[model samples]
Structures are given as C-alpha cells and as structure tokens.
Target: RTLLSARAPVTLISTSGDPPLHIAAERPSAAATLATLIDAGAPLAMRDGRRQTALHIAARAGNSVAVATLLGARCDPELRDRWHRTALHWAVVNGQLGAATLLVAAGATVNGVPMPIKKHLKKTSLPLEAPLHSAARLNPASGAQMIELLLRAKADPNLRDQFGQTAMQVAQGAGWSPAQLSLAWEQQYVHGLDYLRAGSNHSR
Candidate 1:
C-alpha cells in the first residue's frame, strides 16, 4: 500500500535485474501484492536477468497462489525463458503439481514441443521437452500422478522428445514397472476418448 501510495515504479529493475512483479511472483504470500502491482501497471512481459517472465518464476517457485493470480491477470503462460522452456516445463521439472495444474487449466499446451538440440551446448542448458517427458523422467512413484494428470488433460503419450523417444518409452527407461506403464496407457486411452468426444460435440 505504501509503495502504491508513494507512486513508486513497480517495474523498476533491481541490481539483480528482477522487477518487483518477478520478486512478488517468487513468494507465495506476496500473490495479492503481485495482483496489486499488475493493476498498478507492472509490465507482465518484463523479463529478469535470465530472460524469464514473472510467470516462470512463480511456477518454478511452486507458488500456486502467485501462478493463479498471474493467470487470472491473463499473463502469457506460454512465454519461454532463455532456455526456451515454458512455465509448464519448469512446473513439471520442479514437481510443482499445483502450478502445473493451474497452467494446464489456463490452456497451456500439454504436448509442448522441445527446442532443437544444438551442438556444443553449455552444460547448464536446460533440455526443453514436452511436459509429459519431464513427468516421465521424474521418480516413477512420484511422477505417476503427474503423468496421469497430463494424460487426463489429453497430453499425447506418443509425442517424441529430442531423442525421438515417446513418453512411455522414457518412463520405461526411467525404470517404471510394466504394471505402472500399463495403467498410464489405460488412463490415456480413456481420457483421449473423452477429449475426442468433447471436440466432436463442439463441432456439432
């Protein structure tokens, strides 16, 4: 309130190069303040030192409230960072289920395509892959729920990664049991039909 009353610049970059909105998105408790800053005309498209939008910070922080607030403000959930990964990519990589859920609900693509692999890439470069690929590479027990969620959301189980491996193949290589893989396939089968039905009805 004091900052707003003082008419301070909400988009001012810190020495670290992050604006107030990016900082706010990193804190779950600061979600309301984030909304306030947005209303005060904080630039939603403002990127940090790493070229990450506030939405990427919020999702990677697992700050679901901040993610929700930003989504409500209609921020670009599809915005990619320096590594060319979307907020959904960060959410799944960090196992931030709530943030991932919110992004998916807000129409973030489940089958996000990976950036082309370049030769002699830096070791710190993040591998941009489909959200399902990230979920598959996670611990099988923990990633099962995320995989189910994405599958239910109509993610393509057959989508290939940069290595040209399908998510199920990735899951198998990541040590998922035959039974677990079977269950995921079944779930995908059922939900995929529902998605097709929904699309067909909408076209009618």
Candidate 2:
C-alpha cells in the first residue's frame, strides 16, 4: 500500500522489491508498483509472470498516473495478457478514465477487439466482452464518459461479445435507463444498434 498512498512523498519513494519492477507487474497491484519503479529507473519493458507489464496493472487498477508513467517510459500499450486483452481493454473495463485517456494519447488501439469468452464459471469468469460491454455494465458516470472516450478514440461500436451481444446490448442488459442509453449512444453512433440481444442489460 506504500505506492498507493496519496500521502507518499514522491521523492522518498524507493521502488526496491524482489524480482525488480519488470517481472513484478504480472499482478494488478504489482503492476502498479512497477509503474513507480520504472518511473524511478527500473527496467522499462519487463513482463511479469503473466507476461503483462506495468501498464496492465494501471489499466486494471484504473490509475491514470500508473498508465502515464508506463507510457512515458515507453511501455507497450498494446501488450496482450494471457487472455489476449490489452491495457486498453483493462482501462475501459475497470473504468480508469485518465489512464484510458493517456492510452489513447499514446497511440494505443482504441479499436482493439474483445478476447473471447474462453470460460465462464461462477468461481472465475470474464466473457472477453468488448471494452464497451465492460463499461456499459458499470453504468456509472465513467461508463457514459468512457463511451465518448472510446468513440472519440475510434473504438468500434459494432464489436460483439461471445454471446453475439453488442455494447449497447450489454448496457441495456445492465439496466441503464433509456435516457442514459439514449444520451450515450446519441453522443456516439454505438447506441444506434437496437441492442437486440435477449438479456436484462440492466445494472447496479
């Protein structure tokens, strides 16, 4: 939690840890740690146990500082996780708007495709939905804002999940109000689809 503290003085920050920052970023928290480490002169592109870099951590954590730190260090934004999801993928899913913005600015692929629903168990499951699907499911202010972020960044609106569900479909399934859906989609052409998939499309 040292690196996560807003009170941590930036200058006294020592990035020392076992395995160095490069190999430590495989885990979400570790990846976040590595971002600061790399910013402090740790290896720039080392992959962790999962072959993921610090950027992946920032993406998962939704920390814009981590994202920019990695990008500034020349970390690959397009680096894929074992499941083939990129940092961009995680940024949208986890709702890291600032990181998401930096990824776009750094030339990350806003149009990156979904990984594929390789598994879905109650114990462990992520359907490899599009970033849009992930965001819509959140139905938060960031969710709507991310739609615009993705659209302006040129993410594909028509991409589908394993169930052939569109982002709009998932958003509707998550129960976003018609007003919410309409406002989001109207801002970008993504909601133009009928969201025809058969699901609740509702959210918390």
Task: Please report the candidate that would top lDDT against the real structure.
Answer: 1
lDDT of each: 0.81, 0.68
Residue range 43-141, candidate 2, lDDT tens digits: 555556566666787677766655666677788888777656789888888777877888888988876654434442332355756677777887556
lDDT of 1 by residue, 1-204 (tens): 697899888887788888999999999788678889999989888898788999999999999999988899889988877777789988998898899999999999888855456731452355546889899888877688788888888888767666666677777778888677666667466553344345446546
As a TM-score, model 2 comes out at 0.71
**Alpha carbon lDDT at 83, candidate 2:** 57
Q: In model 1, where is the ten-residue run with the lowest total lDDT?
A: 119-128
TM-scores, in order shown?
Answer: 0.84, 0.71
Error of 2 at 184 (Å): 0.9
| Candidate closest to the true structure, highest TM-score | 1
